[model samples]
Target: MRSAGKPRYASVMTDPADFSQSPPQEAAPLDEFSLIRRYFHHRQGDTVVLGPGDDGALLVPPAGQQLVMTQDTSLVDRHFPADMAPADVGYRCLAVNLSDLAAMGANPLWFLLSLTLPEVDEDWLAEFSRGMFELADQAGISLVGGDITRGPLAVSIQATGSVPPGLALRRDGARVGDQICLGGVTGAGLLGLEQWQAGQRHGPAIGHFRRPRPQWELGMALRGQASACIDISDGVLADLSHILQASGGLGACLDEAALPEDPPVLAGCSADKQRALQLQGGDDYLLLFTLPAAQPVPRGCYCLGQVDAQPGIRLRQRNGAVGALTVAGWQHF
Candidate 1:
């Protein structure tokens, strides 16, 4: 199920609509407020009692539920290529943050944007708004309020969601004997980046990197079934290590042969490199979680291993030998 080509949000109406913008043209530079009024303001969801245009947006929580909030900040040349399309920049920033809500098993509600641009480019702003709103609409999340100012190119989003008071998924509840699992394969995100850097315009890797989907529905399905949950923002080994450490320094053993096959784009790569890519590549955005041994794992999830009382990760090779596995993954610093 590789999604290839421009993301669904790529084709948007040029006419005024959700977060409408007049056709781009030469105009006087926009002041901060003018910028907000044109590109950042849009119809908010029901959760926003009063949105954008006030001291602060007033929001109401759902009855019998608690709020789940998360934020992610991305920068040009660091999080994305310096010359990436404004539309893709908008979609990628927000979509990645929504994955956090999914990990918490929360229902999408509203979000706030804090954008910094080096210049007020009307053409860029129009495309950016359309891209952001397209994903926002699909996720059932609305933009309530935010800030915009002059600075380097940057995108920050604070996504808010609701979950039944006691049922939010977390990373600390996993234990020995729980089966470790993943919603999908890895390496695609990094492969897409390689494709982009290589100047290929369209392919599975390009689509995966530019517009990766959050595993929201699967997360919701795992609310009661999963013992512990997290999304793969860092590589799986790194993110899974968090679950292990949080759950009291547990360990796990993975079956090498049981790992999902490499994405078709990686077929030309060597076997060892393929394994490393699946384990260490970042940005796949798949949910990595654990379930009780006796419980049936959800469909579409690959059961990679079983949590153990041991202190570190181990890999069970196809021939039956088990060896210590070093847990290395994406480093924030």
Candidate 2:
């Protein structure tokens, strides 16, 4: 197994596939405002401008640019384990949304959270709020306003941020011959979730899934340098295909040998199976980006492959064999 410090994309390994045979029990819903006040509200600094309890959140935009907006929702059974820690759930809910803003190279300003629970537990809400605030504090974003409703356990967050003029990274910007780059590790979170569900005791992999560390700083750094960018929310190959499709016939060639690998992952499975898992698993919120081939790849960026005129995504294996990359990842439909 490789050291944990190595790039996650490069290390490839597989593990025994296990899934929960039955669903976990659910939690009852509780008070809306108290829950918000206890967990999702508050701010660390003046960047918040407007804290929770308004019609909408107000934030200061960059000197000459417009604010970018993104909203994401995580459900109890679908998005997370019903029995998972409330604090981790709260933190992940906010972190994933912030990741989207990061991909756009936006400085987070304020956010709105709409939470629905069957019945709230004071202790759960407290811990959850603490986790959410801890991460929000790090990003300097504030919770402004949102609604609370009675429903199945669900957490929905809408985040707003700002970036310099004409610099927000988007899906439609990749061009043929652009170099493909990935920021940070991938697959650890998905593998972690799988392990946790299979009765594996808590460890680093599970922690990666529950509390993902969004590369906000790296996202900010890539703002002007990357021509196209997208957070790997679904899966690496699947998300990268969005860039290709948007670029009108532009394709991607992913270098399988160059992807970072997780030590635990390598320790768990055969090399071939590991490669398959790495290419298909999701919940890795790392950023996938493209830059001009002529420009030097920036620090913290991994040179995965390049944009080709071939019109579809392909994987270049270690032995020089090329094959079609799967579009499998998380899917709602």
Candidate 3:
């Protein structure tokens, strides 16, 4: 933690006799350039074609015919808490962008980050850089370059990846009668947010909200089999709409009974509310893809619905009454 009026890059006195062993004292503020030099520059990796100290980054493309690109932004008080751990924030800021690449069936390659902070806290920056480097190394992606600006707390990351030529999964490939399959559990992140807002301390459900591991392997496996693919960032119903409209199709028969529910979510809400959250809540980040009805769904995936040529989405209840499915996900406005 950095305190008010401290230099962001000040030397730390680690000896207990030298410094009080109370709560860690915050570091002093630093200028934008110094902050970057200390935390964002010269990371140990060879994939970085252009390191920090420029307007943008340059990356070496994999020896392939196609490339995939995606960008994601997280805002303070909007995407996360102002006082949240800097390490978690750094990890998630990059993770969400990587999820977009996974949806396109692209291999993790390189990334650039842009950070805006209200103040420069050395301790916070150290932890944040550690978190970003840890995840990037695990995923085999390099931090090429980025920028730091003084402003309200916000973090934005842009990631670039490679995919085999002409094989990247897209939204327009879904066809009539394609079966909708979902990877991993849905609604866990949303339920996590609810738990956090309710003042609940650390738990598995809430942890999902803080750090989401995108299904990179599953995404690569879906490269050729999936007719259409989209990560559930804006909730299942709303994101599915992108595939539906792009494919010029509609009326997916979502079996409410077939939807998977995380136990923590089920324990927190009633059955009806749980169903609603699963359908409308956002930030699941799991892959929702469509494949031919005759194809076998990969293991660990579930059949959630079937595509139709009808004009709107439909939900089939246990009672057998069908109605228009509501898209009640995230609203930036």
Best-matching candidate per TM-score:
1
C-alpha lDDT values of all predictions: 0.82, 0.76, 0.78
Q: How well is each residue in 303-325 modelled by candidate 2, as lDDT tens digits?
A: 88999988778888889999987
Number of clashing residue pairs, candidate 2:
20
Q: Write the per-residue lDDT of candidate 3 for residues 16-122, one digit (tens) a residue.
A: 23323332457423444556677876454555567676666665566754878899889998988766788988887888987898899988887778777665567
Candidate 1, run of 10 with poorest lDDT: 1-10
What root-mean-square deviation over C-alphas does model 2 reach? 12.5
Number of the top lDDT candidate: 1
User: What's each prediction's clash count?
Assistant: 1, 20, 9
Question: How many Å off is the CA of 194 in candidate 3?
Answer: 1.4
By TM-score rank, best first, the candidates go 1, 3, 2
Alpha carbon lDDT of residue 264, candidate 3?
A: 57
**Lowest lDDT 10-mer window, candidate 2?**
1-10
Can you rank all candidates by lDDT, best first? 1, 3, 2
Off by over 4 Å in 3: 1-33, 42-46, 54-58, 261-266
Q: Model 1: residues >4 Å from true position, as ranges? A: 1-27
